[model samples]
Target: MIATLIKLLIGLLLWVGLAIVAARIVFALPRVQDRIDSTALDPADVGPLAATLRVRARGQEGKTGIAMLRDGADAFAARIMLADAATASIDAQYYIWHDDLTGYLLLDALARAAERGVRVRLLLDDNGTSRLDAELAELDAHPNAEVRLYNPFNLRRFKLASYAFDFFRLNRRMHNKSFTIDGRVTILGGRNIGDGYFGTGPAALYVDLDALAVGRVVPEVSADFDRYWAAPCVHPVGPILGQARRDGAIEDGLAHYADDPQLEEYLEILEGSEIVTRLSAGDLDLEWTEAALISDSPAKGEGAARREDLLSARLLKAVARIESRFDGISPYFVPGRAGARAFKALRKRGVSVRMLTNSLEATDVLPVHAGYTSKRGTLLRRGVKLYELRRKSASRTPADTLGRFGSSGASLHAKTFAVDGKRIFVGSFNFDPRSTMLNTEMGLLIESAAFAGNLHDAFDRELDGLAWRVEMDGLKTVWIDPESGEVTRDEPGTTFARRVVLRVIGWLPVEWLL
Candidate 1:
C-alpha cells in the first residue's frame, strides 16, 4: 500500500509539471499576434492651450512652469480640467485604474475629450485593470480614442494563472504614471487612478504630489509617452478584447457623478480652484525651474533592460550630487541590506539623511513593512533618522493647512526625495528592490531649492506633529509619538495577528520580491 501511495504521488507531480508546460505553450500563442502601433501628434498648431503655454513660457526657454498638487482633491481637478482644456491630444498612462468612482470619472472625462476630437491615448498595466474590460472598450470605441495594455495576460478571468505559468515575465510591471495634454503641459507623480489615491471612496485618501508642468519638459513627457506606446509589449485593446460595443456607460457615469449630491462639495472645490483656469489663461503661479526627466528603458518590462538605461542608475547619479542633506518619503520603503549600506555611506559623508515611511499599521502592503523592518535596526545604528507616519482618524487636521502632501490619517503613498536642499526627485519610485530591479519607473529631477526646501521643512517641522520618530533601544525597537512623546515597544496600531503575519513573512526569503 505504501508503494502504491508513493507511485500515486509521483504521478500527480508529473501531471502538474505537464499542466504548467501546457499553460506556458498556450500563453506563447497570444504573444505573437499583431497589434497596432502609434505615435504622438506633432504640436505645430495645438490650438489655444498650446498658445497659452507658449506665451507663458516665452522667457524661460529651458525652464518648466511647475505648480505642486499637494491636495488629493486638487489633483483630481487638474486632470479633469486638462481634459477639458486640451484642443489637440491627451496622453495618459498609469499602473492602476480601478473600476471605481474616481476611475470612471477620469475615464468619462477622457471619453468626452475624445468626443470633442481631441486624440486620447490610454495605456495601462494589465495587472491593475483586471475587471475594467467593458469600460476600456467604451473609450476605445470612440474615433479619436485608443487603449492599450502593457505586458498583458492572455487569461481574461484567471490572470493569476498566467503568472503561475509565466511568473518571470509577468513579475515585472510598468509603474510609470504621467498625463500630457496638447503637447504643452503634463502632470507626473505618484498617484494612480483610484478612489484611494484621490479624496473619495470608502478608504482613507492618499496625500500625494504631482507637478503640473509646461515648457521644455512637456515635449519630453510626450516623447516618453510615445516610446511606451510603441513598445514591443503593448497590445491594442481593440484587437485583444474585440471592438467592444459603445454602451453609454461612460456618458451616463459622468452624468451620475454630476448629479450625485455627495460629490457636489468636490465639484464646488474644482469650480473654485484656479490652477486649471490659470493654466488656460496663462498666468498660474508657477516656479520656473531647470529640470530633466529620468526614466527606465521600456526593455525593463521584459527583464532585458541595461544598468545604465535604468532609473536606478540615473537616480544614483542624482543622489551622488548630495552634499548636505537628504529628505524623502516613500510609502513602500523596503531597503534591503545593500540599501542600508548606501544610507550608511551617505551618513559617512555627513549628509543629514531623514526618511518618512508608512508605519506597519498604516502600510497597505503588509509584507513590505516586514521588508522594511528587516533593515530598520541597521539603518538606525548607522545614524540615519527614521520617521513613520502614524494612522489617525480621517478628519481634517493642522496638516490640511500645512501643505501636507499626505494628509493626516492617510497612508504614505508619495515617493519623493530631496538632495542638498537644491534638487528634488519626484514620481512613482519606491526605495525597494522591486523598483530598483524589476519595475519600469520615471520622474523629474528638478533643480529647485524652494521645492527641495519644502521637503526638508517637512522633516524639520511638519512631520513633528504627523509622524513618530523610530529609535533603537538596546536590541528592542521603539517608536516615540511625535505629538505626545508616548513610547511603544510594539508596532503601533497593528493587531497581534498582523504582527504574526509580518514575523512569518520576514522569515521567508522574499525580501527581493517585496
Candidate 2:
C-alpha cells in the first residue's frame, strides 16, 4: 500500500509538470500578426485650435506652454473640452481606464468626436482593460476610431491561466498616461480614467496632478504616442475580438451616462471651472519653460538587450544633479536596498531628502504598503524624512476649490518629485522595483524654478492637514499626526484583519513584484 501511494504521488507530479509544459508551449506560439498600419497622422493639420496654439507657440521657440491641473473637476472638464474641440485627432493612453462613470463619460466624448470626422486612437494596458474587451471592440467599430491593447494576454477569458504559462512576458505592463488633442495640445501625469481619480465617486478620491502642455513638447508627446501605437506588441481590438457587432450597445452606453443625474452636478461644476472658462476664452495662464520628455523604451518589455536609454537611468542622472534638497511624492513608494543606498548617499552629500507616500490606511494596495513597511526602518535610520498621507485630508491647493464634494476619504495618488526647488518631475513613475525594472513609464522634467517653487509651496501647505510625520523613537517607529499632534505606534486606522494580512504578506519574498 505504501509503494502504491508513492507511485500515485509520482504520477500526479508528472501529470502536473506535463500540463505546465504544454501550457508554456501553447503560450509561446507566435501571436496573431495582422496588417501593420503605419500611416503618419500630423496634428498640425487639425482644426483652428492647433493653428491658434501654433501661432501662440511660434515666438516661444523651444519653450512649451504648461498649465497645472490640480482639481479633479477641472481635470475631467479639461479632457471633455479638448475632446469636444478636437477636429482632426485625439490620441489617449492610460494604464487604467475603468468602465465606471468617468470612463464612460470620456468614452462618450471620444465617440462623439469620432462621429464628427475626428480620428481617435486609444491605447490601454491589457491588464487594466481585460474585462472591457467586448466594449472596447464595440467602440473600435466606429469608422474614425481605433483601440489597441498593449502587451495583451493570450487567453483573455482565463487570464490567470495565461499568467501561469507566460509569467515572464505577462508581468511587464505599460504604465503611461497621456491625452493629446489635435496633435497640438497634450496632458500627461499620474491620474488614470476612473471615478476614483476624479472626485465623483462615493469612495475615496485621489489627489492627483496633470500638466496641460502645448508648443515644443507637444510634438515630442505625439512622437511617443506614435511609437507606442505602431509597436508590434499592441494588438488592435477588431482583430482580437473578430468582426465587430453592430449592436446599439455603444449608443445605449452613451445615453446611459447622459441620463445620469450626477452628471448635471458635474456639468455645473464644469461651467464654474476657472480652467475651462480660461481655456474657452483663449486666455489660459500658461508658463512657458524648457521641459525634457523622459520615458522608458517600449523595448524594455520585449526581452531586448538592456538599453542605457531607460527612464530609470535617466531619472537617476537627473536626481544626481540635485545639490540642495529632494522632495518625492509617490502613492506607492517601496524603496529597496538600492534606493536606500542612493538616499543615504544623497544625505551624506548634505542634500535634505524627504518623501511623502501613502500610509497603511490610505494605500489601496496592501502588498505595496507591506513592501514599504519592510524598509521603513532602514529609510528612517538613513536620515530620510518620511511622511505618510492621512485618510482625511484638506484640499491640495487654494486653486483646487472647485471639486469638493465631501468625499468618503482621500488618498494620495500624485507622482511628483522636486529637486532643490529648480526642477520638477511628474508622471506615472513610482518609486518601486516594479516601476524601476518591470514597467514602462513616462514623465516630464521641467527646468523651471517657478513651477518647482509653486509645487513645493503647495506641498508645504498640505503637509500638516493631509499627512503624518513619521520618525524613529530610538528603535521604534511612530506616526505623529500633523494636525492634532496625536501619536500612534501601530498602523493608524487599519483594521485587525488587515494588519494580520499585511504582516503575513510582509514575510513573503515578493517585494520586487509589488
**Clashes per prediction?**
1, 0
Model 1, 51-107: lDDT tens digits are 777788788988988887877778888998888888889999999998767788789
Error of 2 at 398 (Å): 6.7
Per-residue lDDT for 165-227 in model 2, tens only? Answer: 678888989999999988788999998998788777464788788889888888898888888
lDDT of 2: 0.80
For model 1, the run of ten residues with the poorest summed lDDT = 393-402
C-alpha RMSD by candidate, in order? 2.4, 2.7
Best candidate according to TM-score: 1
Badly placed stretches (over 4 Å) of model 2 are: 1-14, 24-30, 257-259, 274-277, 305-307, 394-405, 459-462
User: Candidate 1, after superposition: displacement of residue 200 in Å?
Assistant: 3.4
What TM-score against the true fold does each predicted structure earn?
0.94, 0.92
How far is 390's C-alpha from truth in model 1 (Å)?
A: 0.9
Report the CA-based lDDT of candidate 1 relative to the real structure.
0.82
